[model samples]
Target chain A: AQSVAQPEDQVNVAEGNPLTVKCTYSVSGNPYLFWYVQYPNRGLQFLLKYITGDNLVKGSYGFEAEFNKSQTSFHLKKPSALVSDSALYFCAVRDHRDDKIIFGKGTRLHILP
Target chain B: GAGVSQSPRYKVAKRGQDVALRCDPISGHVSLFWYQQALGQGPEFLTYFQNEAQLDKSGLPSDRFFAERPEGSVSTLKIQRTQQEDSAVYLCASSSTGTNEKLFFGSGTQLSVL
Candidate 1:
C-alpha cells in the first residue's frame, strides 16, 4: 500500500518570506508525486508533479518542489509568500500497481502580513 | 467548455434520503474519478472509471454509495440512505490517457446531511 505523510498540520509564514511545506511518502517502486492547493469550498487545483526528472520541479504560482529520492520527500517551496497564497496544500502519491492516488491529510498554510 | 463540470453545487438532504450528484468530464477524456473530501481534509479517492467501464471502486465508503458513467460521457454518484457521516464535499475529476497527465477538477458538490 502506498501512503503520503505531511507532518505539519499548519504552517505560518510572513509575507515576502520564503515558505516550505514538508511532505514524505512510502511506495513500493518509483513514485509519482504531486502537490495540489484547495481554497475554501473549492476543489483542488494542481500545483506541480514530479515524475522522473530533475530533483527540482517548478509549478504554478511561483511554487516549486524538491524531490529527494533518498529521503522520500517532496517538499513544496516558494521564494516569497503572499497573503493570497494561503490555502490548504495536499501531497499525493500514485500507487504503482493500481494507479490509485493516495493523498496526505493536508497542511494549512497561513501567510501573515 | 474545456474543464470538468459538476452539478448541484450544494445539496441539503435529510437522513435516509437519497441524493445524486452529476459530473461531466471534458470531451474525449478517457478517465474519470470521484472523490470525497471532508471538511479541512484532503480528498480521498472514491472510484475510477475508464470511459464507460467502472474499473476501481475500493475507496467507496459503503455499499450505499454507487457511481456510474453510462455511455462514457457523463457520470453520476448516487448515495442511498444518506447519513450524517456522509456529509462532505464530493469532487469529480477527469484526465486524458497516459500516466503523467494532470487531472482537471470540477468545482465539486457539497452535501449536507441533517
Candidate 2:
C-alpha cells in the first residue's frame, strides 16, 4: 500500500554543478521520509530524513533534500557535485503507523570531473 | 562502539543448500532488521526483531527464511532450499526503539547461489 518511485535510473552531472535526484511516494498516512547512499559493494549509509520539519532538510556530505508534501516528493539535492558523491541513492518512506520502510528503485549518480 | 556487523562477507551456496547469516548490532540497539537487496535495487525488508522477540516476519518471502535473536543482542537469518533467486546481498540493520529512529546498516553478506 505504501511505495516510493524514483523516476530516473541514472543521473549524470559535472563536477561543481548542482545535481538533483528525484523521488516521490505513495502512502496511506503521514510520511517519514529518508535518503540513503550506497557505494559499490558496501552497505547503505543514512543521508538525511524528513519527519515533520522545515521544507528543506540538510544532511551529510553537503547534501540536502526538499520535502514537498503537496507533490508527495522528496528530491535529494546538492549545491555542487563532487566525484566522491557518485553512488547509488535511495529514497525511502515509512508510514506513521508502520515501521516498515518502502524504498524507491534507486538512482545511480555519476559525477564527472 | 562498533556499528552493525554482518559476517561471512561472502557466501557461495549450491541450489538446495542451506546458509546462515549473522548480525551483531550496536551494543544497545533494540530493533534489529533483515533485508535482501538484489543487484541495482533497494533493500527489501525480510524480518524484524524487537530485542529477543520476533515482532514482524511479514516481509519474509517464504517459509524457508527464518530469523531469530535469542539474547536480544545478536541475530541470525537462516535460509533453506536455496534457489537462484536467493542470490543477493543480505543486509542487516539496527536502531534504537521507536519507529522513527534512523537505521544503521552493515556491509552485508553477498550470497551467490550456484
Candidate 3:
C-alpha cells in the first residue's frame, strides 16, 4: 500500500517570513509526487509535481518544494509568506502499483499580517 | 477553452432518493475521473473513464454509485438510494493524457443527504 502523511494539521506563519509545510510518503515503487492548494469552497489547484527531476521543484505563486529521497519527504516552502497564501495544502502521491493518486488529510496554513 | 465543468453546484436529497452529477471536461481531454470528498478528508477516487470506456470503478464505495461517459466528452455520476453517508462533495477532474498527468478539477457538487 502507498500513503502520504502530513504531520501537522495547521501551520502558522507571519507575513514576510519563510514558511514550510511538511510531507512524507511511503510507496512500493517510484513515487509520482504532487502538491495542490484549495481555497474555501473551491476545487484544488495544482501547485507542483515531482516525477523525476532536480531535487528542487519550483511551482506557481512563488512556491517551491524540496524532494528528499533519503527522508522520503517533500516539504513545501516559500521564501516569504503573504496573507493571500493562507489556504489548505495537500500533498499527494501517485502509487505505481495502482496508478491512483493518494492524498494526505491536508494542512491548513494561516498567514498573519 | 474552458476547464472542467461540473453542474448543480449544490444539491439536497432525502434518504433513498437518487441524484445525478454532471461533468464536462476540457476540450480534447482523454481521461475523466470522479472523486468523493468528505468533510476534512481528501478526495477519494470513485471512478475513471478513458474516452467512452469505463475503465475503472474500483474506488466507488458501493453498488449505488454508477458513472458513464457515453459520448466520451461529457460524463455523469449517478447515485441511487442516497444515504446520509453519501453526503459529500463530488469532484470531477480531467487530464489530457490517460496517465492522469496534472488533472484539472471542477468546482464540484456539494451534496447533502438528509
Candidate 4:
C-alpha cells in the first residue's frame, strides 16, 4: 500500500519568508508524488507532480517541491510566500501497483501579512 | 463542461437514509475516482473506475458504499443506511488515463447525515 505523511499539521510563515511543507512517502517501488492545495470552498487543485527526471518539480502559483530520494521526502517549497498563498496543502502518492492515490492528512499554511 | 462536475452540491440525509451522488467527468476522460473528505482531513480514496470497468474498490470503508460508471461517462456513488459518520464531502476526479495522470477534481457533493 502507498501512503503519504505530512509531519506538521500547521506551518506558519511571514509574508516574505521562504516556506516549506514537509511530506514523506512509503511505496514498494518508484513513487508518483504530487502536491495539491485546497482553498476555502474550492476543490482540491493540482499543484505539482514528480513522475521522474529532475529532483525538483515546479508547479502553479510559483510553488515547487523537491524530491529527495535519499531521505524519501517530497517537500513543497516556495522562495517567497504571499498572504494569499495560505491554504490547506496535501501530499498525495500512488504506486505502480495500486490505483488508489493516498493522501496525507494535510498541512494548514498560514502566511501572516 | 470542461471540468469534472458533481451534484447535488449539498445533500442532507437523516440517519438510515440512502443517498446517491453523481459525477460527470471530463469528456473522453478514461479514468474516474471517488474520494471522501471529512472536515479538517484530506480526501480518502473510495474507488476507481477505468472506462466502464470498476477495477479497484478496496478503499471503500464498508459494503454499504457502492459506485458505478455506466457508459464510461457518467458515474454515481450510492451509500446505503447512511450514518452521521458518513457525513462528508464526496469528491469525484478524472484523468485522461489511470497511470501517473494528473487528476482533475470536481467541486464535490457535501453530504450531511443527521
Enumerate the candidates' DockQ scores in order: 0.66, 0.73, 0.66, 0.80
For candidate 2 chain B, the 10 contiguous residues with the lowest summed lDDT are B95-104
The digit string of per-residue lDDT tens for model 4 on B22-89 reads 99999999999999999888899999999999999998999999999989999999999999999999
Q: Higher DockQ: candidate 2 or 4?
A: 4
Off by over 4 Å in 1: none
- lDDT score, residue A69, model 3? 92
lDDT of 2 by residue, A1-113 (tens): 78999999999999999999999999999999999999887778999999996999999999999999999999999999999999999999998988788788899999999
Superior by DockQ: candidate 3 or candidate 4: 4
Better of 2 and 4 by lDDT: 4
The collision pairs in model 3 are none
Give model 3's TM-score for chain A to 2 decimal places.
0.97
In what order do the candidates fall by TM-score, top score first? 4, 2, 3, 1
- Please give the CA lDDT of all the candidate structures: 0.92, 0.92, 0.92, 0.94
Tens-digit lDDT string for candidate 1 (A17-68): 9999999999998899999998876778999999887999999999999999
- How close to the true structure is residue A89 of candidate 2, measured as C-alpha lDDT? 96
Better of 1 and 2 by TM-score: 2
lDDT score of model 3? 0.92
Model 4 root mean square deviation, Cα atoms: 0.8
**Cα lDDT, model 3, residue A97:** 54
Candidate 3 lDDT over residue span A4-98, tens digit each: 99999999999999999999999999888999999987789999999887999999999999999999999999999999999999999986556
RMSD of 3: 1.2
Q: Which candidate is the best by TM-score?
A: 4
